[model samples]
Target: MDSGKARATPSFSAVRTKRAFEAVTDQIRTQLANGLLRQGDRLPAERELAEQFGLSRNTVREGLRALEVAGLVELKKGATGGAFIRRGQAEVVVSSFSDLYRLGAIRAEHLTEGRLIVGTAVTRLACQRATLEDIDLLQENVDDSAGSDAQTALSVNLDFHRLLARATSNPVLIVLTDALIGVQRELLKIYEPASQIDVIASRRRLLTHLRSRDEVAAVSEMEQHLRLLQSHYLEEDFRYRRRVAAEAKAAGEAASDEA
Candidate 1:
């Protein structure tokens, strides 16, 4: 027996007609969980899958589409293209979080709180695990924020957190940080920039603490910085609401005068 031989295709069983596509997905997922299928393995052709599952080709395609949307598989094009198992991506989580925010399931306050918790943990880990090169890259990020315009400064500042997350050397944390930051970016669009906050100075201080391997100080600095940012966001949101209300009132009065 060839121990290193790979399975060419998964053996799918017949599924009933009721919710047939879901059954198809469930079997594929089970194959994945059981190690019968692995990443980069090309699934059988649609006709073959349909026969195996005792379903129509359209049903099999629907199942594949669901898997693709869930980030479980990649559907490629051309004669060489088929449904191939794909590696997990951070964007899936980021998209899910962004959707939650859009549906009002995640509010600004929830996002800020989540950032504070994750940022502090990431900061502590970075202080312990960061290499000299990582620290240097972070320093460069901070330097780029200096004297930048509001938009440029925001971009650099966000990159600084991403760099810090990478310093942890943990893929899971990196994904989580990316997701939280992604949603926060959307929230930031509703309010004005953090022009009043001295972000560069705080980052500089955090960098010093990271270099010294002072986990306590680094975590403290990160928490304080996030709190200040949250305060600014809340104040800006209030001002934005008030301004909108005043504008509506003025518009209504002007229309009355015209009448």
Candidate 2:
């Protein structure tokens, strides 16, 4: 018998007790959510967390890594190096959505629908609640977009949406909307350089509507702007699907010939 086979399977009971890194991550997340940990609060040393949880240092490290990616904790180095709670983290939430899109877990239509719902709501709220400062911020973004290259313009355009969301003064809405838009921005990775002209014109129109404070017009403009943006992605998706179907048909024919 092979040495490994001779050793026999580990007892089911032993395997059942095996540690999972995600379990440790969940516990830390629970602590943070329960307010047992507050922003800027430092976590116990890694060795302490490991010992407390009856886990290896590597298990504890994995938990910290998860929390760090989630934007819940920050690990710093220097005289003081430990995990600390973070304040509001809309960007991280957004990036997480982007990752999902890249993995083919989300589609272009999902992004378009999210944009319609969130974009319209935020535009309406900004119309009613935006202060002079908020309007100025939007104008600044418009100016920045005018001279930016394609990629830079996309960044500024996303920033403009973030500023508009913040102008609503609803932290929950801002965070949630940013999360959806973040996914859309990630998908834009393939199309940004080609979208320069559309982005420039869209930014200009949004600023105009906001400046005029026409709530109805602003909302309408936003919807139309997003429609234009969605069209580009939809076209790409249509092409991709066609290509995939052709490849599948070709593969089927090859298999039949082999048989």
- Candidate lDDT scores, in order, read 0.89, 0.77
For candidate 2, the per-residue lDDT at 125 reads 94
Cα TM-score per model? 0.88, 0.74
**Residues 133-219, model 1: lDDT tens digits:** 999999998877886777888978888889999999999889989999898888888877665257888998999999899989999
User: How many clashes would you count in candidate 1?
Assistant: 0
Q: Mark the 10 consecutive residues where model 2 has the least summed lDDT.
A: 7-16
The model with the greatest lDDT is 1
Residues 18-123, candidate 2, lDDT per residue (tens digit)? 5567777777776766656667777778887777777777977887888888788888987788888777678786777788898988888888778888888999
Worst 10 residues of 1 by lDDT: 1-10
For model 1, the local distance difference test gives 0.89
Error of 2 at 98 (Å): 1.5
TM-score of 2: 0.74
